[model samples]
Target: MTLFIGIVIFLVTFVFMEFMAWFSHKYIMHGFLWVLHKDHHHKDHDSWFERNDAFFIIYAVVSMSFIITASNTWFWYGLPIGFGIMAYGAAYFLVHDIFIHQRFKLLRNANNWYARGVRRAHKIHHKHLGKEEGECFGMLFVPFKYFKK
Candidate 1:
């Protein structure tokens, strides 16, 4: 593919990952796989990591597989796709782990409209502490109601 097309594909993939994050968080994480995701809602462990972190490894493996395929095979578009997944994963880590959960005591002063909205939405979501009756499964694309002044 052309450079422009590759960039477009990369951008699209980045955007698409938001929806995937939402869908996976709602249906998969909160569904049959709640056993792994429950720790994220509640701090039942003394360790710094949660069982939900397994999903990061899964996505890393997927991105690495795409990259390996691109390097060894003829499908070069996989490079953009792989990087897009990796970039989204990094953003998710920053926003969810660092900003929202304060896992590292960073971004605690972001205090912007988007930051406030995201934090509020996530706080509302964590209020459930259970798989069912959860709201705001999204990370980036939060509902506007949370942003209202």
Candidate 2:
């Protein structure tokens, strides 16, 4: 029963993180923190990393808090939740950074329909180099209109 609960917690947390990602990207990142996220849309630095990458630290601290709470407190479900958040982060990095942005030289040839759709949606998001008037969608759950037929 505990294992099943843990798995459920993990899956639920993973799905919830998608909504959180979209919310934060639209409101927080594009809101006051546009100073950081704008560089992602516009190239102002020569380094391999963007100031926008700082956002990950917030999620990292959150995930670590969950793991530490699980270790020292009664909230054992935090373990699964932490892992779920980390897993979603991994997926976002793989799809957004590695596959879509080509931050690394891998996953560049994933020419499937889903991959194309994700890329197209992201392309639309990046079309606006500013904070306002941008459409921020979930990483895994893009609109069907963005997908190809």
Candidate 3:
């Protein structure tokens, strides 16, 4: 029963991370913290990294905290929660950075309906080079309108 509960908690946390991603991207990243996220939209530096990468570090720290707490506490639930957050972060990095932005050039030839849709939606979002007026959407749950025919 404990294992089952842990699995459920993990799945729930994974799904909830999507909402958290959208919320943070829209309000926090594009809002007051635009200073960190602006370089993501506009390439102001020659380096391969952006200040926006700090957000990934923040999430990584949160996941690590949960894992460490789970290791020391009786509540093993934090283990799954931590893995769930890390998994979502991995997916986000692959889809957003690798696939969409071609940062690593690994999944460069992945051509599919879903991939195309994600690319299209992200392109629209990047259409605006500023903090405001860009359409921010979840990586896993892109709008149907952006889907290919």
Best candidate according to lDDT: 3
Model 2, 1-149: lDDT tens digits are: 99999999999999999999999999999998899899999989899999999988889889999999999999999999999999999888888889999999998788988998999999999999888989998887899998886
Q: What is the lDDT of residue 12 in candidate 1?
A: 89
Give candidate 1 misplaced runs (Cα > 4 Å). none
- What tens digits encode model 1's per-residue C-alpha lDDT throughout 84-121? 99999999999999998999999888988898888889
Please give the TM-score that candidate 2 achieves against the real structure. Answer: 0.98
* Number of residue pairs clashing in candidate 3, backbone atoms closer than 3 angstroms, sequence gap of 3 or more or interchain: 0
TM-score for every candidate vs. truth? 0.96, 0.98, 0.97
TM-score of 1: 0.96
* Model 2 RMSD vs true structure: 0.7
lDDT of 3 by residue, 26-122 (tens): 9999999999999999999999999999999999999999999999998688899999999999999988998889899798888888888999999
C-alpha RMSD by candidate, in order: 1.0, 0.7, 0.8
Residue 16, model 2, lDDT: 98
Query: Global lDDT for candidate 1?
Result: 0.90
Index of the highest-TM-score prediction: 2
- Scored by CA lDDT, what does every candidate get? 0.90, 0.92, 0.93
N/CA/C clash count, model 2: 0
